[model samples]
Target: MNDADPLPDLDPLVPSTARVYDALLGGRDHFKPDREAADVFLSMVPHAREAALVNRDAFLRGVQYMVREAGIDQILDIGCGLLTKQRTHEVAQEIDPEVRVVYVDKDPMALTHGRALIDTGQTTTVVTGDLRDPSGILAHPQVRAGLDFERPIGLIVWMLMQVAEAEDPDGIVATLMAPLASGSHLFIVTWPDTGDPAQRALSQACLETLGNGWARPVDRVLKHFQGMPMVEPGLEFVPRWYPGDPGREVPSAEDLKPFERTQIAGIAVKP
Candidate 1:
């Protein structure tokens, strides 16, 4: 077995962000540390976990749009937590089972789960690496094995960039998206500091304690995907991004203000 294998000596005492998210999403793979961390974020805003679920749902819709509308079959999902139940590859492959997916995350527990669920790189791979480091991420054996940059690829950086605030977020994304073909697509969801007084207050409180990284403004957050063609109604709250369920109402521009909704999402085409 490879030394980085996820099964052995998994650290339960130290918090795993992916495991923490798993717990938050009502999954059973988390430890006490994960639970405690989740509580801290949740306490700040009762709707914290709800926001995550909403964002995940939007991600599914966006992936479907990429496959059905844009006809993109290759996906590179950065920060794919735990590769849980309903995920990027699963949704994308439902449309085209051969859709190649490369999941990138630095969590050992997430890597372990990926190994158990996704067997090889023939069409899908779970890679262990930090999203902040494009070199290691882009050059990962699994990413190279599954995706061809010479062809169009869909990039999904969902609910993850908050950890990379110290690094140049814009530059990182630019570097990552630079090599894709013309029809390639980039999808991003950022936890912007919500504009609503209560939401912003709550998120601010969480950021103070989490200290994982600082939050960003919505405009600055959208700026991460410059030089890409952001289609109509670009960069709105996650719920506003291509909703699969027609019954869902897009949050009003007012309700989506900072912290009111945790994710600012958009799908942009590489022109």
Candidate 2:
């Protein structure tokens, strides 16, 4: 029932990855720098906006499956960006109204906006935390209280590993899941290593310009799920995981032409 903690400072000049993502999703909380950065990405791949939506769809579908099929009720959404119409809590709660969700993000803006737009009751809450500090995040008051680590929980990491290298992503994943009892699940949705040359160039451009973002092959992504047992339909193009589901429709070959290799997603459960 407590309010979300105060967020850190906001740096407008620096192009925020979160804001750029928000802009890509047609969200209204971005600044000039975010738009400029997003435009740079669009210049390389005009379908970047479509790609973003595809990723969102994949994320929502993954959460829905976890809640409805996996029988999970607690979720930890790491690196959750600005508010969106179909957020993690929204999707999970739709399946199970009592589902408890804890939204975590390093961005101060995300924390502030999440409280205002996402958190509506005791079942959901927002906290300011960094991906680099997985231990801290797991130990946060909100996370500790909102979730029962002794039971199963869903951990959502959408496009976050691309930003982490020092922590040995596999190690980070292990560290984060160590506290949770067996049966917990982790969902990872991120840029795929395979894509059009133009798409690769655009990804590099964003890295050079905004100093964030990276893409890895599916094999590399699987490494992060090392100890966890793969959920059915192991790593594949995000849309391919659970195709034809309401929010997770797999586009026709023609509709997927422009973004066929844009993103990859998978879910794995702790043994």
List residue ranges in candidate 2 displaced over 4 A: 1-4, 243-258
Cα RMSDs of all predictions? 3.0, 2.9
Compared with the true structure, all predictions reach lDDT values of 0.74, 0.79
- lDDT per residue for candidate 1 within 1-271, as digits (tens), equals 2454233357778776688778778888888878887887787767777876886787788899888778899999888888878878889999998899888877777877787788475787787767778777887666787898899999987544455555778888888888778889889877666455545644564455445544577777778887677855677777677622445556686666443466667888888
Candidate 1 regions exceeding 4 Å error are: 1-10, 198-202, 205-210, 243-251, 255-260
Task: Look at candidate 1 and give me any clashing residue pairs.
Answer: 194-258, 194-259, 195-257, 195-258
Worst 10 residues of 2 by lDDT: 243-252
Cand. 1 TM to true fold? 0.88
TM-score of each: 0.88, 0.91
lDDT tens per residue, model 2, 1-271: 1444567789988878789989988888889998998998888888788888877887877888899999999999898988667877888888899999998887877877888877765888888888878898988887898899889989987556456576567777778888887899988887667645744765685786577667776677788887567776778776576822435455653355556577777888888
Candidate 2: pairs in clash: none
